[model samples]
Target: MSDAYVALEGGSVVAARCRAPGTSHGELVFTTAYTGYEESLTDPSYEEQVLTFSYPLIGNYGVRSERFESGRVHPRAVVARELTDDVAEWLTEEGVPAVDRLDTRDLVGEIREGGAMKCGVSAGPDASPEDAKAALAECPGMSDYTDIGAQVSVSAQKTYPGDGDADTEVALVDCGAKESIVKSLVERGATVHVLPYDVSPGEVSDLAPDVLFISNGPGDPANFEAAESLVSEFVGEVPLAGICLGQQIIARALGGSTAKMDFGHRGVNQPVRDLRSEKVVMTTQNHGYTVADPGDLEVTQVNVNDDTPEGLESDDLRVLTRQYHPEANPGPNDTLGFFDDVLDMVDCRTPVAAD
Candidate 1:
């Protein structure tokens, strides 16, 4: 164990006393999520990013391999006010850098006001302002990391047997899919064919799936050109749906545009309103970018706090998307029925059988 410290883009050490002897750098972002540290650490969307946990104490429940969202940890580093024995041990074993024993309140406030910034963390006792400055210089900007999504995406196609009763087959294009997303489909009796981020529309069409599912992932949606092309090719050809990064891609495919938020939403308590019913549902979410304008797509749900687009739909195209996680592994399942909508949409397109 060694002393650790965290530095921001300005070369200022925000916190210190890190015990792990590892160094990391990335965009410094905070998540107000109070639980599910394991799931958050493994979420692919956190790739190339340093995560700050706003919760006072972390790792109270210990680690479990089954709780991981991805096969490996995705965050570059983690900052917290206090780290429990179980958590610190798990992070160390995983080779994930972490820092604690300092005032996270000040650090979080700095991020809240200044927004997420590029940052560096080191577990060496000799960490200083110069070390911080040098690390900052080496840190790449978020937009500059265009290959992040592909880096986290599956290398080849994989298939999961759907547990749902329907004969529906779904072609899932994995940008950086979460394990829960796959489970969500398979448990619902839908066979999911997971493909690479750059898989062509022709390849997916050849699968003869009843629906096209775009998965939530890392990086900017604009950087995923092949996925956008696939979406463009299948807009009217198949029933389409996505979540988080998937939502942004669908927006881009429909001529809409996404923008990086000043401070992105990441937590389980975000309230979103279903425009049709004007009803609010607390949801789980994690993303730095959002669909600012849905273009020709109809807006279905909105964030109650910021009025950002939370969900989109198009009856004519049979396309649907949500910015929050419906699978809700670490949060509420209020929108779990959202999957039912996908099934219903497929059912509508299914030709009735004659007796």
Candidate 2:
């Protein structure tokens, strides 16, 4: 026998001699992103959650440093249908360890039937699967993920490379924003100021930025009333743009509402159709909630797959929001023109005094 795969839960040895890690206690959730494993693992949104990959074979292409969204992997633990013994060459170069393989199908089934619970993975002769499952059953579900934004946010304000000697300044509200978004803004020649997620409108007004940007984040957008109020206060004062959580926050600020999705979109293959241009763009996304009352704002783009609202723009308020990521980190580059569009918006709204 293979030492009778042992399972452990809540630090107790429930299974013994398992092929997988002994036990890892956390709220288990599955992702169907297909690829971009490195990005998914490093996403601050998955904090405290054990991730299970629905795609059976993983780590075949291996991990690369260039693909990492952050400095390190942040998942509580990783579960996969089968962990590859041989990772790609880039992963070896980056020194990322091959994921300890597990029966992902069993893990996903258990999470679905049992309704998402805390669990652990361990490696030892004494580890028991039964004990692991029992301990996980006692753990909680994903209820307080809204707090994740505050936890992962940057501690202090910072700036990144922007279009050198730019005419307009853009204030980027960092709700655990990806570095690539900063890079995109910088490349556009727009001076960028990265602030904490809770930055107030008064602070932004004091900066006198030409544009405001809200970055993507994790968790329920409804919990961020302060951010919504701040954006509302800044409406029409400056050209504003947002992605993912930023989009939802802007919608709420504009008298709209947001709701959680049955299974939140989290991948690179999502298709969004631009209403004005009637162009289809394959984009990346990682959000749990979307605007509920898009009519309150001017809807700009819609998802063809499910008819979900994808983008919104309010000409009266000089603000725009997109539910998908245009940064294209670990995804397609079809929608990168959105960055230029933002620059144009800022140009159109430029204060005559600054110009």
Candidates' C-alpha lDDT: 0.85, 0.70
Q: What range of 10 consecutive residues in model 2 has the weakest lDDT sum?
A: 1-10
Best by lDDT: 1
Q: Model 2, 87: alpha-carbon shift in Å?
A: 7.1
Clashing pairs in 1: 4-18, 163-186, 163-189, 164-188, 164-189
Q: Point out where model 1 deviates above 4 Å.
A: 350-355
lDDT of 1 by residue, 87-206 (tens): 888788889888888777888888888888998887766766566566667899788887776788888889988774668888888988899988888888999899999997667867
Off-target runs (Cα >4 Å) in candidate 2 are: 1-27, 85-126, 134-143, 350-355
lDDT of 1 at 106: 83
- Predict model 2's lDDT versus the native: 0.70
Residue 256 in model 2: lDDT: 85
